[model samples]
Target: MFWKKFNLNKQYNILYLDYNATTPIDPRVLDAMLPFLKENFANPSSTHYFGSNINESVKTARIQVANLIGADETEIIFTSGSTEAINIAIKGVAENYINKGKHIITVSTEHKAVLDTCKYLETKGYEITYLPVQKNGLINLNELNKSLRSDTILVSVMYVNNETGVIQPIKEISALTHEIGALFMADATQAVGKIEIDVDDFGIDILCLSGHKMYAPKGIGALYVKKGIRLPAYTHGGGHENGLRSGTLNVPSIVALGKACEIAEQEMQQDAERIVSLRNELENELLKIPETFVNGSIENRIYNVSNICFKGCDANVMIGRMKNVAVSNGSACTSAVIEPSHVLAAMGLSDDYAFASLRFSLGKFNTKEEIKSVVEILKTELEFMNS
Candidate 1:
């Protein structure tokens, strides 16, 4: 396999362009987290030296998550990952405010985290409106306006599309949701480390983010809820996370996440400038090939992602032949589905176009040379496609 080198242990060198999927943990984050795993491990709720030390780390991590997204420290609650964070955000709101309104709104292009959560809520009798997107893969705001009713309690959208790297018009969408008196929730999973976010300016009531996508270890994330926004507790026990999410915190992972968030704040713009240029270089080169078209709004996308749909080759076959590249056919979540990308389908793309899609997400460690090499590898593989 092309990724065998990355799969194997030491000394292997393969370029990675899948940052929107997940990022490598920064060395600085690991250093800041060493003590928690080695010596200072504590159950943050306890009252002792071990606990006191962890208390500081947990508090610091909360502040770090808040700083990255421009939210208040008290508003951030620790979770297992963005999936759980999203679950808490959506389900929490659905159950808490169901009495006021049972209608919830979200776009069809949302990650499975939001969709599956809403699907579960649907079983509970909540009305969900899956808004359609344009051929370019953007949600229709006019349709959103029409969907909002007096009984609409929440509207959830993603700040960034994970597959295509398209950025949603969050500020405008937030304003629309507010006008209808519905609370707005955004899954900022793809935007947390790669883009800048100011919760107050964006006017989002709740947001979800993952640490692993921004260089923190997996199994640790946070959910941000604006002050005064009440959500019912889906996770019940021992009254942790201010009675919102009750669970023991992952100290080492939390510390790592906090440090990762700090790095994201300090380096996000520079990283974006570099990654965007590299992604463009790769995409521009792909344009030289006869059959490839960059998916979504190329000009209005996150710096770290590019979804390319090649004309003649199937992604399954092309994906296997790109021995010099590490990319995905669609999303990691739906890889097992073996079907055309749902994101592409929602954009009104034909099955051929959808099945031919590939996602190449760049990251901080990516370089110009790597971009050129990946493009060459793709070209070579495209030539090898029989059809």
Candidate 2:
């Protein structure tokens, strides 16, 4: 009923199930953003009256974002997106803490932003240990414990896997990293709005999230750096975001992200209840199809995602044929790459099964009717493909 007030035009009669890739901006978020985009526009860093007022709005937004994740408002640093935040967190630590160590530990299944950033660090003589995951898509704690070393500066892990929705053992990982005197970071882009997160409770020294992943507009995100942690400046301009990230603040999108975070804090429990039920119904029915299996640890995943391996079905072809049904085979970032998902491959899936997998990610806007329609469409498409 709440979603009914929002006009989801369902462009081209499509049923969208790709929330992990990005979410449609909530009408409430847009409403909060419009004022900044038009008459209220002012440089938050300026001393002028209008700019002073706009700066207050940005401060409120910072509090809103921090409140959602149980962080102090001062801990939040605005960035362009998760990629930028990840880069700042990883690269900044490497730069500032180079005297202490040059080694970092991250998982093999991390998003390209983290993986590629670590790869780049390798050229600078940093030692990166990419921990492998089990078939259920969870990192082994023992392996992580053994991997921790005196030279390890940071341990970066994602809170949830974008494709399979696999929730990682962040608290345990953080504990292990701390034992070796290393800071812990989490890319919570896919986890922040979808689940509860407390930076202090989880021992997260640094965390990053993208607004677009949580029903806010694109080009806005935040990095949470714990108190007493100092990261090197990411940009060199009029010092913004506590001199960590610089340049003009994106006031409109920041307001939108704040509103989205507020809304998510209020509605996450109910949203999870409804969406998980729909996800279970869809997953159960789809699993009835022959040779289908779920990917990742079903018991340890987020409520909205179901990555299913449909043996013998080419996921790319299946997606292409479903003209009005929007889903994905893997991360949208790597969609252009011809290779199968490195995540699935790291979890020991053969190329065939990896290519056969499809990710169905539900969102608050999706309805039971839409789920049924999607299931029917997939069944029909699979039958035709088999024939």
Candidate 3:
């Protein structure tokens, strides 16, 4: 009924299961954004009355984001998206803590935003230790402990593997990072709205999340910096976002992200419950195919995703065949690369298995009928491929 109020005519034409790639904007979030785009378009930095009112709205949006993650309003820094937020957090730490240490630790399976940023830092004289994950797509705690050194300035890990839906032990990882007096940062782009995250409880020094991954429009995201942690200015301008990221605020998208966060806080549990059931139904049915198996730790994965490897089948070809269905082989960010997923490679999957994998990520908007249709489509496609 909630979705009925919106025009979902185009969405119904495809069986979209790629929530991790991005999500459709919620109508409620869109409604909250429209006024900001039109009548309330004044710049938040302007000194006029209209600008002051718009500033108040931005303040409210900041509070909404903070509340969702159990952080203070002052800790939130709006950015273009997770990539920008990640660049600020990782590079900022590298720059500010250069005198303290030149070493950093992150998983081999981190998103390219984190990996590529760390690589850039390496060119600047920082030593990066990329810890490998287990076959189950989980990092070894002992290895992580051994990797930590006195000169390690930061340990950055993603809260969830976007491809496999595998969740890391954030609390445990943060505890270990703190033991060695290093900061912990989690790229929570894929986990924020799907799971409950208390940055303080997890001992996170820095965290980044993207709005587009959680039913808000693209080009909006926020970074959480724990109080008392200071990072150098990421952008030079009017000292906006606590002088970290300076630019004209994206008012409409910010409002949309705020509304999405508010709605997520209120409805996440129920949405997860329904989505997990549909995900299970889809996965269980798909596993009936020959040589098919899940790619990650079933016990440790998020409820909405099922990354399965269909042996002897090429994922790209299968995806091409399923014209009416939308699934993915891996993160959309790396889709342009002509290779198997690095995440799967780090998990010790063979190239064949990695290329054979498909990620079905369900969301609140997906339905049982859609799941069944997707399952049937995949079944027929696989049968034809095998034939």
Model-by-model lDDT, in order?
Answer: 0.85, 0.94, 0.93
Per-residue lDDT tens digits for candidate 3, residues 29-115, read 988999997899999999899999999999999999999999999999999999999999999999999888999999999999999
Q: State how far residue 308 of model 2 sits from its true place (Å).
A: 0.3
Ranking by lDDT: 2, 3, 1
List, in order, the clash count of every candidate structure.
Answer: 1, 0, 0
Cα miss at 298, model 3 (Å)?
0.3
- Model 3 alpha-carbon miss at residue 32, Å: 0.6
Ranking by TM-score: 2, 3, 1
After the best TM-score superposition of candidate 3, give how far the Cα of residue 248 lies from its true spot, in angstroms.
1.0
lDDT value, candidate 1, whole model: 0.85
CA RMSD per model (angstroms): 3.3, 1.0, 1.2
Model 2, global lDDT: 0.94
User: How close to the true structure is residue 342 of candidate 2, measured as C-alpha lDDT?
Assistant: 93
Q: List the residue pairs that clash in candidate 1.
A: 17-361
Residue pairs in candidate 2 whose N, alpha carbon or C atoms collide under 3 angstroms: none
True-structure RMSD for candidate 2:
1.0
lDDT of 3 at 258: 92
User: Which 10-residue window in model 2 sums to the lowest lDDT?
Assistant: 4-13
lDDT of 1 by residue, 104-218 (tens): 9999999988999999999999999999998878887899999999999999999999999888899999999999789999898998877789999999989988988988898
